[model samples]
Target: MHNSHIFDKTVLREYDIRGVINQTLNQNDAYVLGQLLGLIVLDKHGTKVCVGFDGRESSPFLCEKLSDGFTSVGIDVINIGCVPTPLLYFSSFFFNADAGVVVTGSHNPSKYNGFKISLNNKPFFGEDIKNLGIISKNYSYVKKSGNKIYKNISNEYIQRILKDFNGNKKLRVVWDPANGSGGKIISDLVKFLPGEHYVINSDIDGTFPNHHPDPTKNENLKQIIIEIQEKKADFGFAFDGDGDRLVVVDSNGNALLGDQLLLILAESVLEDHPGGTIIADVKSSQILFDKIQILGGIPIMYKTGHSNIKKKIHETGAVLAGEMSGHVFFADKYYGFDDAIYAATRFLSIFSSKTQNLTEIISRLPKVFNTPEIRFFCNDSEKFEVISNIRSRLISSEYKVNDIDGLRVTTPSGWWLLRASNTEPALVARCEADTLEHLNQMVSILSYELSLNNIKLPISF
Candidate 1:
């Protein structure tokens, strides 16, 4: 193929391709990506590719160009229309396609868009993503007539999700999709669930006018918490823009962090699979890992990215895994991919099976003080060097450090972490301890470490 197209370097992320719409990404880039992906599939002796997009305004046009590129290469395209990222993943299996792609920006602002790719049911990321850039500049293209088929798998996806429901009691539940792509499907799904359901922001609005689509932020979760309180519901579930992340709120209108939610899911999963392996990201609270060990399951702390956790789960044969950023994966009965809708269903099933409420179950866990992920400004060029400096100093001082993804130092009272953000010009930090005073001490220690490198902690404990 003589169609020489170059992608902006910033768009080629570690896990997926993402960029500001029109500024750094456009129709031509999407078209070229489809062509390259189609070529890769054919090279692997595959014939069909599944394509889906989110509710972003730019998605449909990009999806159109992407599908054209796929068909131009003699690779049949199974278009799943506008749906969540998980549904795109499900389509790959349902249609027995060789490759899958989704046009989504995930939890980012509306002005951004990107693609997530998969080959043969495994995540196509890291070096796989970097290779696309090289291949786009130079590659032989196949010219043939391949077909594009439009299929709506909403009914099938909803049916499969509900099939896992084995609850013994009916409960009032609230769902907040935050006007994301999952709104339409979740609205349809609640109709079949056995409960009094309340769905807010059910419209699929690309603007995300209600609030940011990220459920991890407390400000974004306020609406759902309010809805839960007003409706007097058992609990509420909030999903990110592409429906790949989840946040749960108890009846008391208190939001649960991702690690806390993961512990809840782990209890049910370990009950079914004794001594199973459960993976949590490095940034997750140590309490979560300890709880998993106490539940008679093996806990493995891995990297922070969703793709990293997913890869680790595949390698370790783990049944469940999650990150602190609300990306939860369940491979016990379903595919091992992050799906907020499926996670919500599983949580509901678990909740309805027990007599204890979410608060009660969570209250049984050991108490600890921790800080939210704190990201401070640091030049992208210098962030890694700063981390390296800190790590070297910590190691020289005989600090117990885990450098899997970044530097996680084991303190006497608890632990503290310092890592560079993968997608931004910043450094991330967190500290945890058994008491408020210990937590403050940990924060001071982290601050002192940063100060050694001419940096200061943005917030005080």
Candidate 2:
């Protein structure tokens, strides 16, 4: 109980701790996390801690080991059993816990798993995450025994989400949890709704039997599209692996990216609270910002990642925030964390209470050409330096560059963005233009800049 355990340095990231489970992460790492995270809570004047885990195959083993570490350190632990990350966050408030931790891989492949920690009800990330590695590697925990108990908040969580479902219209819909942790939650949720509903892959399978459980990839959503079209459903929704992210499929089976969904959600949030500030990640389309402004809500673009957006919302008092990867946060009437299940319910409520022309509404937005986020290989150590060098080059050429998150250049054609991803060993770039030719040109500029750093842009993402 008094020996330090050094973790795989690569697992500690800016947003959350993640890595390929057995390869870079194992039971010892999980135990170290519990001890270190529990110490953080105690140091911050906290006592009780809530713990939850996803349906990943390795999640249960990690969860048990982590709980042992917490109890070994005299941190009272409340085990919520298998649940989505959002529900774990909710447990913090419902049980008045000092901190919360959830074992989830998010949208990564099944081989991946990690922990997301929340201290004092706020996200414990950035320097705090890195410090976990630093501190755990240096010293060990004191030997102390604590208590452990189990609590089930599933019924309460389901009912609380349904309380706000006072929609005017009832439309048939298809729900897909992608066989992740949210499967049971969705299965329970649809029964109480007014609309006729059909759910696919509702079994909580950590192996992700149906598709990879990632809705962002178009292929994973194809079956849901077919289900929606054949069932004559109004709209379809899908969740990422851990149920913290969501993707929407229109009636025509067209998938609307997160940027488009944020614009639509703005219509609902701004109608009730006009002139409120709304936040989106830097990679969002310019149209989204303009639309939010037009809707009478101020739009602020911050760095990508749910943790960053959550912190930005708390600091700026923004009513809503979302990322292109489908992590939507709502601070208006609920906790300001990325809860895909909650976001789906809110969107349904808005769909029924608000206008019915969902397709037409999105189509009416001003048309602009853009390329999907293009990710290219880059070393973790050099990606930031590459971006820095690229920024210097852009500045020397007098190009308008916004380096808020990474390097976003405003050009006559449109805006091109290049930023190092927080989660992976790669650089992400996006381009937007009024025309296809201009879009290509902007991408070419990004490519040329990367070439200068001896990095070649991938052919496509």
Candidate 3:
């Protein structure tokens, strides 16, 4: 039997192991990963692990190989079958496992499949990921067969998610799971929720026949928008492939941005935990942070990745935290992990308590014009360099900049962000302003900066 193997360097990402199946990731890679993770868990005095997979074509085969490898190392495995990423995270706490791994590609396309891991409920990332590479190159293990037990905790998960649903409104709601892992959970959840529910694409289809599972792009949310408008529902909710991120559509079929949703949720949280610290990624609108201050809550800007934000929330004891990508973490009355299903319940509870509709509530907030996150191809090798150059230039010119993750520069009119995507070989950019004219100017500034680096801003802008 082989004792060592090297992984594709590209798959060892900062946050998780991920790559296109068959091409960059294969069963052997999964087996090796299982072995490496098993060794790590054993070292930490942990005897059991929770394993789960999403509704991806390659997920089952990969999961089996992973389990085989884990068992070969005498590590007991608690298999949770196919489920959303949040459920996998939840399994860690429910089973009291020392470690956990989920076979999922998250918001990536259907052809891609990989893993997200947690150790003792903490996200295993950054240097922890790098250490996997070093261990895989040379490691020794005694092969003693362990046990694998299958567990179906979906009902318990559903019950826990509904436990926080305090909404008494019988409002009509539309749910679109995009045929991903969250479909079954949402299908089961609506039965208990006190609302007129219409669910679309709840069938588990690995092919994702309807559309791409990502909700961040408005294009993917088209179906939900139409359903909400045609059905005249109070609102709608959409989920990404792994169901951790959320996209909400109002009664007018308008999809709310991640920051907007954060602002809405913060309003309720701040009331309960007065003078509490609420965290948001740097990409969030300035208006969100300003409003937090107005609500008598402390607002902190942090790095963009979910792992980064989650860790920050834990370290600071913050009541709530979120990313512009729709990953919201709540420490109040729930685990401090992003669970879109739970978030949906909380949102409904808050909305039911109010008399005004979603659109009206949104209208009352300060207005700001901003571009959706724009991503352009940039080689992984050079993406960081490009951001560094821009950061240096901005600082030399005495521009107010936040470099927590990348460069978020503030100007007289508004602010702009240029950051390298941690999960893809692309540079992500966004800009915001109080007026259309100022928004255009901010975009122009962003474009000019990219031009200096021999990169063209996406022409669609």
Candidate 4:
């Protein structure tokens, strides 16, 4: 361990360990991470660990070394092989493992790679991840394990989803895995899905030779939309790099935002479990909260991180929860981790139900014009201060401001939110109104406020 490079604090983020390969994280980092994580699991709980990785080129190499480190620590390792983050999460419960770790860069660029970890089915994040950094600095050797096992979890996970619905109707689905880990498992999973699936960019390429894997951006879904229209498919689905999040397009190639999809899923879940707790992050529209209330469900607004959202869900025992960024969690019929594949399956199930088409379902919701997430570049240290200044200004004004995560100020016409992104060095702003002019007006007001504080508005409407 003396030759191993020290772990950087920047790479040990609040939610996960992520960094550029070779630059911040490499094989030695992976090995040390494995040892510390294995020790954490063994010391805190027991030795059963489930491991999976994404389609990144460095993922396999890291997974191999990480497994060796875990085995060296006297822990039993279950290698679920290359799969999505959600698949790894699902395997955690399916295999009854004590902990799990998914090697993925998530929606980051091809050069990035990281781990999303869990202990006893809960997110091992924040101080937990930071604690690993502390352990790494001390760097003590652990006794070698004579007990290590490699088991396959695909069959169990696949069976759980398949058992939900029999192959009844053939659905024409245009799926773009975006050269992600989902590409490797989606084809096989859909084989029993009773659907004529037309998959594009399904090859697992770490270079991302097609397009970026983030489905939230409209530009990334352009190819999938075109394929859906050309193939006359019922709908098209796109997954982020690790497949924990999803973006949907209808039969006519209309893109459906995550909140819209949540509305649809909420309706279905509320039907089965009325008055159940439904949670959404602050980034989501007020329309979701209103809809949840009207449908006899309790709506709880929470913070904006996936791990934060999951922890809230477990604490409140919320049956369903979602984020505007396409991360949807369902505790109603499945485990509560965000799963894009399972969400797509649920969407398909709804499409085949007695309800209306996706377009029709969306049309039934109240119309509100909303700006997509507007990110403005800012120094990480100064971003929070900028938000604080804006908050102080809003407090003196004649607007109702909610400072749950950032600043969500409400007016008669609409609402505007200004918050710092947890993952990136940018301030995220969004405005929504019943009319386009009102939305624009809100944006202008936000810009003026930022300008007054000597903080240049980094985004334009």
Candidate 5:
């Protein structure tokens, strides 16, 4: 009663289905996934679905095959070709589609590609995604073919993103899309927004000619930093590959960490929606949580991953949520989905009435020495176990720990987090303290713990 087609295990990740082009993933796999998704939608009594793809060379072909499977399953496919993942998500909400999917690699390397999906206006991931693969292995199709329609929501989407523009300061700024999918929309976004805007690497080049699109990494933000300072702009915004995440660089070219960005945005968001819950991933600094409470808003620490944060935001009615990796979701005046372009606009709106610039706002926050998220190689099979053992031992050692997503240990110096990455086979850790010496002391503790577990320390850290 069912047909089974096995897919590469590695491609079905905790967040989304991703893999190297033509290796772990291929056109046939896309078709199978597309068909599986269509079947699931129909079973849920859904008819229409929105589909989009990024700028990768393989995207066009993948999108075509994926659509074919959907159409064959009698699911009306509204194809919004070549857009950022956020825009795809927006389409689901804007057009009120029952489901949606975007073929994208996100911030991964050029060779990588993946799909981000939404069902019934919420993130469809984790077990939902794995279940799709499982059903794919046993699915039997019915003879039905749905119609395909082409729609371009680019202009409408950009207008919606800028509709609530509260910016009046007309500050000078630089925006870098890193030659990723956000380029097209960013180019149009600046045109209508109130600002003296400048942009670099805004071409939708999948090869990522300038640098990898992940602004969290310093190397990716280098060119934008150089341009902003050289042009004497007020600030800079760098977008990740699919444009959902944003990295802000001050006028002096110092990029604000993700928590700092959220902290800054939270202050403003709380002004209108006071006492609103603000969610930050466990990797965020303690200062962010403390500051959120001081600002009269509830601070919730949750697991990492955009989908996880989005789900938590929906469940708790949070006004805002952000991760250390630059994913910021706002529910105040917009959908509770991460959008770098919208976040950028909101960040700039803060400048509308303020005399002080970007850096000045951050200058007031208490300073802490912290390490950027440091990841070490661990076999996928063992990474989760490693974190579990670390958590058990830490608790047995009488150390206070928060096990929301992973084991976050509290120390007199500061706090340290050890979590298995949901997206990769690695354990991610971050440490922070009032001073550099204390910070290293925390690192030493982390190293000692890893050594005790027989995991060799990564020399780079």
Candidate 6:
């Protein structure tokens, strides 16, 4: 029975089950996941589920099969139609559903698609997702039957944001949805907001003809920055393939890294909840930690992945949390799921009472030189081993090291990080310091350490 299906054990990843369509994942795979997840949800939460999908080419077919599988197992499926991942997360709480699933490829290539799941308002990830494979193989059941309800959740989601923020200040904001699922919602959202909005690539196109929907890469954001400059806008925002992550640009068209944006949002959130816990992934700069401390908020550095950070945030009851990859989660005034559109709205709200622009606020922060993420490819089997070897070497060294996610060594001038990429067969490294010279020195040390471990340095900048 298993061999007859297209589900590959390799495709069922740690965080979300993703793979190349037709080859590794097909209608049967989606149906199996739907059946397994539905049964799992019923066993754990005893309630219905909310299902949504992004503008991926494969999403519609997967959603249909998954819905069929859910109904086959006597589970109620609230189909929210095509929406961003965050909108589905919003429906989970807004409708009081048991769980939710977002069919999205995220920032991956167009050929891939996957599921990001939430159960009982918490992330269903890591081993939870992996164990679904076992459940699918072992569980014995006949397809009983259930029901699927179609609902339009956009208006309610829009109203929630509008109600939370009521600002009369007018500003010029440029939005680039990159033709993802967020494209459908951004127009309506900007319509209600007080802004002179210039939207580019806001039409839902799964092919993403203009550019890949990932905003993390500078190339993907070029058009948005150009539009921002051409229009002389106040600021700009870009959403990822699924619209869970956000990238921002200043009025001058300077791309704001996620760490910098996190600092800006953290300050605003900490105003209402003094000394509240704020979580940032280990990939964030040490400057962010120092600033958070200076702001009178507790800054805790945790593991990278969105699922890991969200779980830690729940455990610590943090008011806000974010990753350097632009996944910003707010527990202060909204659901904790990372929502680019929601974050963009909240960021604009920060300018309501101030004449200071985003660039000005960013300039006020202490400047620190940092390296963009550098990735070096490694075999999947060798990736963890390389990190483990590096960790062991750092343990006996004079440099202070943090092994939270992988290894972060602190020097007098700055810090350097080397971690295994969760989604790919690559080792991710970054360095930062008070000076460019110091940053270069840290990078050199990292290079020496990796060499000692016999790992080849592929690219250096």
TM agreement with the true structure for every prediction? 0.98, 0.97, 0.97, 0.95, 0.97, 0.97
Name the TM-score of candidate 3: 0.97
List, residue by residue over 1-461, the lDDT tens digit for candidate 2: 46677788789998889999889999999988888887877788777899999989999999999999888888999999999889999999899999999999987888999999988789888998888877886766688988999999999999878876778687888999998899999999988887789999999888888898889889999999999999999899999988999999989999898999999998889988899899999999999998999999999989998889989999999999999999999898888988999999998888787655578777888899998988877888999999999887778675788889999898876999999988789999999999989988987888898889998888855
Across 398-427, the per-residue lDDT of candidate 4 in tens digits comes to 999989999999999999898888777888
Error of 2 at 352 (Å): 0.9
Best by TM-score: 1
Cα lDDT of model 6 by residue, 95-180, tens digit = 89888888888878888888889999898888887777766666755567778899997999998877767567888899999999
How many angstroms is residue 86 displaced in model 1 relative to the true structure, after the best TM-score fit?
A: 0.4
Clashes of each: 0, 0, 0, 0, 0, 0
What is residue 298's positional error in candidate 1, in angstroms? Answer: 0.5
Provide the lDDT at 41 for model 5. Answer: 92
For every candidate, C-alpha RMSD to the true structure in Å: 1.2, 1.4, 1.5, 2.0, 1.3, 1.7
Name the better of 2 and 4 by lDDT.
2
**Cα RMSD of predicted structure 3:** 1.5
Candidates' lDDT values, in order? 0.92, 0.89, 0.91, 0.85, 0.89, 0.86
Please say which candidate is ahead in lDDT: 3 or 6: 3
Encode model 3's per-residue lDDT on 1-461: one tens digit a residue: 44979898889999999988999999999999999999898998889999999999899999999998899898999999999999999999999999999999888888889999889998899999989988899888999899999999999999898888786878899999899999999999999988699999999888899999999888898899989889999999999989999988999888888889999999999899999999999899999999999999999999998999888978999999988888989888888998898898899989877888898998898988998888889998999999998987888775689899889999888999999998789999999999999999999998999999999999786
Q: Which stretches of candidate 4 lie over 4 Å from their true place?
A: 1-5, 166-169
Off by over 4 Å in 2: 396-398
Error of 4 at 115 (Å): 0.7
Best candidate, lDDT: 1
What is the C-alpha lDDT profile of model 5 across 1-461, one tens digit per residue?
35688889889988889999989999998888888988889989999999999999999889989999898888999999999988999999877888999999988898999898899989998999888777877779886889899999999898887786775788888999988899989998898877689988888999998898889988787898889988889999999999999999998889899999999999999999999999999999999999999999999999989999999988999999999889999999899999998899888888877999877887988989998888888988999888888877888675679999888998877988898888778888888988999998888888889988899766576
The local lDDT score (0 to 100) that residue 438 gets in candidate 3 is: 96
Model 6 bad stretches (over 4 Å):
1-6
